[model samples]
Target: MTATVTEQVFRLPDLGEGLTEAEILQWRVNVGDFVTVDQVVVEVETAKAAVDVPIPMAGKVVRLYGEPGTSVAVGAPLIAVAVPDERYREEERAGSGNVLVGYGTGGGGGRSRRRARVRQRQDEQPAASGPGKAASSSKSDPLLGPVSALEGGVSGAVVPSVSTSRLAGTPQAGEAAKPAETAGGKASGPGRKTAAKRMGEVPRVISPLVRRLAEEHGVDLTLVTPTGPRGVVLRRDVEAAIAASRNAETAQPEVAPAAAAPSHESAEAERVPLVGVRRAIAEKLSRSRREIPDATTWVDVDATALVELKESINRACPDARIGMLALLARICVVGLRRFPELNAYVDVERQEIVRLPHINLGFAAQTDRGLVVPVVHDAHRLTLAELAARLRELTADARDGKLTPQQLTGGTFTLNNYGVFGVDGSTPIINHPEAAMLGVGRIADRPWGYEGEVRLRKVTQLSFTFDHRVCDGGVAGGFLRFVADCVERPEVLITHL
Candidate 1:
């Protein structure tokens, strides 16, 4: 008895933060591999961060839709999985009700299985390999499901637009097949020769995605030898061509780039793709500048006391090395309490200033990926030490690219520690929607008047940018003054608690 087979198509879902697309960083499974529900199948880098996507069902994967480094839009088909009819029936009866965000598992049902197409007058069957081999794969129906037609037996490439009926004429059965003649008089099978020419044929590719990829890579599809039905060039064929072209380039000896000499003509220019998180940042910053009528107020603070307090605490608890930024952040929370207008967003549509009850303090952290602000929720409620520990952990996580969407947003106010970059001060733009941002400059020994005597003190510049519409100079100055006083005195912060 021929066992029945069923296939399911899994589409990429929206990764949070209103992301429209994500680039496939890596795939965890390949064709013919069995996968369980909720198993992480692919790692994708979105506009915010890298995240893993889980498969929603248990089945044997028949085809993977995208290659690594390729961008796939949300709701686009990602992979196709096939399973036996009985297994599918069992899944339906038992109903493994697993669900994912934006996608849900309802009643399980099977889709129509693609039929087999036999080549006429073929002398022998092509060896089963890669995508062609399946649990129910057979000589008569060597093509197990839609994947063989879609991927054209190539791994990691999508070629779903091609129909199985259209692949170039397969060898007739019981008739001696003639191998295509090469320039060297060596005989090659029609399939292999067909693939060689399929890489250059653009019109033969029916998938819009495949065409776009061909255009991007500058692959002449007309020269591509089609391996799919009706002489259609598969996506894999285009990628293979690209890979071969790259290999040929690497095989040749490299010529030194003239950029090394730093000549005006040869000055090295590199173009980085402004996509994903970087693009999102650019758009957000641009929007902030475009929308917010922001103003700046700064003060040079005597941080000597704050520094000494941190040193004393560290000496007392050597295991917990308290960071200066943590102390400064605690002061910011206190300052926000005194001036709540700074911890709010202006609602232009509603014509209102929405003041938040709780403070979700965001701190600027620079990472290899880029600059990101990780938020500490309910920061106002935490003790100074607790705030310090959480800030340290969150900063480390941000630098390591492990922060989640929740940890990166919902901030009521921002504290920027530009001091780490060895800068003295900067009038930074406010983080959008939020009314203000506090920028801390580098701490350094500067001449100061201590007890009417000339002395050197640890001093730093504190730059504060606030939305002018939120409050006038008086409120902004008062907020900055309160923060500077806390930094200088350290004891004044106790009153806020």
Candidate 2:
């Protein structure tokens, strides 16, 4: 008699970086399509790059939870697969190893009898003899002697033994393993059974190229073991091995020719699909520009005194390490306090303007992933030293892709310092719902007539944009002038407070 098949749901794996979310770019396999283990099932665009997720088991896809363009959180079910026999289900519940799914590992089901036999056979075979038996023997033989060393001491490398335990285990070492007992020491569900069976079939071996390269480069492959399929050394594993060896060499390093040469054959422009944070930023900016009847007013201010102030403050408090951006943020906070109207947000749903008592100043930081606006919450409450420290923390988090949703939200006003890029000035779009945005331009030494005498002074441009319905040109201009006045004579800011 034939056994009945059961369907199990497969979830999206944590793509490392502790990223809890990702956007689905496309699905390679659809419902009812037969997929084998390690076959690419879907393409996902991570914050870092486009990556293909491999199917964990050989089965027919029964269902898909999301479509292209949909954003999904980690651990959310992505696909469903049907497996033959309740026996497979039973094995999954046995607390067996985990199966590789996409870029991560999932709880495994029971191992199949046939798979167990194959593994037994392979394990029984002598490690010294295999397809590359002659080569292995020759390399291992001490009589053959050591190979010639390269300029940097890179010589004959040996293929490292792969460690299946690491790949099957958690990404980090020393973490507590999940308990086998699932509600009274029985298998929690059928999904675990399927996961166990799949993991049992995965083969562990280092890639041939990685092994050869390791030997050629005199890299200790053992130091860079594979974390994929059994103990297969992946390309990344080999590269890491090489890097480790190079770092161990000398205090001062010599550059390698391979490192200097560009790897890509063509200088093709890489096209990035607009989605996630980039998409959200574009949509918000577009809506703000279209609906906010924005008008920008600029002011040229002598920032020479402000530069001197920053230098003196840095000397007094070496640990604080304050910067121009922090000073500008402080000035913006003071100006917002004076012109409380600019610190208000438009409540379109309620058809009313909501004024905020506390300042949440958003700083636009450019990251390799995209532009991120990390807000400095309760900016008004923070001192200059505290504000600088907070800004530094937020900037570092943003670049590292570690900022939380709260850090990216709830901004009454945004400050884009185009001066960092050496740009003079440009009109910046307002952050949606917020009434205004402030743009800081490059600070340069320019000739200015002060009391009928020409003198070189550090000058910068300030541009402010506000929603016309909430703020008229006069109000916007006054706000910009106030900021310029504070920056030009920064001492006035402290006195106003």
Candidate 3:
């Protein structure tokens, strides 16, 4: 039976937990290409992980809403599918069943399914300034849009421009500009409008994320030049303003930057927007540096025993293969049990050191996407064999970029094995909120005192970085020493068993 055809528009469904937006990585199905139910139509990268999204209905893709690298907000139009089935529901509200980790197709596919109203304030009619030159009104902040510079050597949105000084009644330096009075004796003119704009006027911002970003960085939206069409300010505009301000502040006196040298070279450079995983890494690492006062301590350890033990175990049962990282993870679990202070995070608001009931161990894994730390929840509950299997599965998933938000978050402690890169040791930043992290260096045969004689033995360095607000040097040193001791003599772990 031939069913009737219908054009259906599908919005990007909810990406997953804690992720509000995703950058379109690639479109699996192109326009005019037929797709099937539960078929992957696009791949998107969020801050946490990358996952493929599937369409709910079988149809020919009539239109793909966003292009690759476009940051599509949830509930925004993603694609228009022309399907033969009249019974198919709108893919925006209800997509095919589970498509990715943490989130999937369902009612209200996107968080904000209500499309943002695209408003266009009259195609900016800026007042002219000089002869034979296009000029822009500095005070005409229509929809918080951008205004290009006027003639006679002007740059970015600067205060007291020709238009603003002429029509806006520009005040003198250090003088508070009072609102100009009109014929009716009411506070009128560009000055009053600018003041009122700051007070309130329902800013025509389409995304709340933009507003939040500005607030976080203490950026004044008015001062930033809007580069989007029709004077609309985009995120890139704000970011550029931020970079300019930073450079101005850091610039040295008596030595101006190249831009100051009035050259014919345009003051533009290629810039890649920090979006998706890269953005997440920047924010998180910056937070860790800003908030956590961490200290690192490292020690050389003899790993000959641990190495031999792993080889013995693997040889005894090849089917139950174990890895050195899993072994280190086991040691961490045991150490946390002995000293539970390291297995918790600080609550800043309550001024409390909240200890967690379970240990969710996060291990660092580098992938083509980026460095992701996939967590193994409830590590304390898993047996050594189970732990090994779980770690193997997680490492594979992380390398594959298939980890979900649930698997990437909720980590109480972190194990960073930097040795895979053949490095000796590193003072890695403690993953934020988590109290401490243990880093393992490369294990190599080194000369060590064995029975009062120098002998070449397997050795490695263990570095531990912990939040200073947590337990002091005593507890941190004790934890590191214990791990080193266990690594040197694997039999000592039997005591805890």
Query: Model 2 residue 430 lDDT?
Result: 84
Q: What would the per-residue lDDT of candidate 3 be over residues 158-266, giving only the tens digit for each residue?
A: 1111232221233334443344334464554455435534554222221334445666777877666556532345567777877787677665565367547554533
What is candidate 3's TM-score against the reference? 0.62
Q: Please provide, for model 2 over 1-497, each residue's C-alpha lDDT reduced to its tens digit, 9 standing for 90 to 100.
A: 44455555567776643255565666798655676656778777555334567755555565555445445566766666666645434544443333323333233332322222222233323423333222211112121122111111111111225343332232223333341223354334434323433444222333334445667777654455555433444555666766666555533444598777545443334334354567667777788877788878888889998999999999999999999999999988988888888899778788898889889999999988888888999999998999999999999987877665557777899999989999888888888878888998899999987768999999888888888878777778877888888888887887977
What is the TM-score of candidate 1?
Answer: 0.72
- Which candidate ranks first by TM-score, i.e. highest? 1
lDDT of every predicted structure (CA atoms): 0.72, 0.65, 0.69
Off by over 4 Å in 3: 1-10, 16-18, 30-38, 55-63, 80-276
Q: Which is the winner by TM-score between candidate 1 and candidate 2?
A: 1
**What are the per-residue Cα lDDT tens digits for candidate 1 across 1-497?**
65677787788875665577777777888766788777888888777777778877677776666566556777777877776667656665665444434654332335532422223212123423222233333433332533333333312333345432223333334434433334555445555455435433133323544566778878776676556544455566777887776666556444589635543432333334455578888988999999999999899999999999999999998777688988888899889988888889989998999999999999888889988888999999998789989998998888777776667878999999999999999999788878999999999999999899989999999999999989999999999999999999988987776
Q: Report clash pairs, candidate 3.
A: 145-231, 146-226, 146-231
Which residue runs of candidate 2 sit more than 4 Å off their true CA positions? 1-75, 78-271
Please identify which of the two predictions, 1 or 3, would achieve the higher TM-score against the true structure. 1
TM-score of each: 0.72, 0.52, 0.62
Of 1 and 3, the candidate ranking higher by lDDT: 1
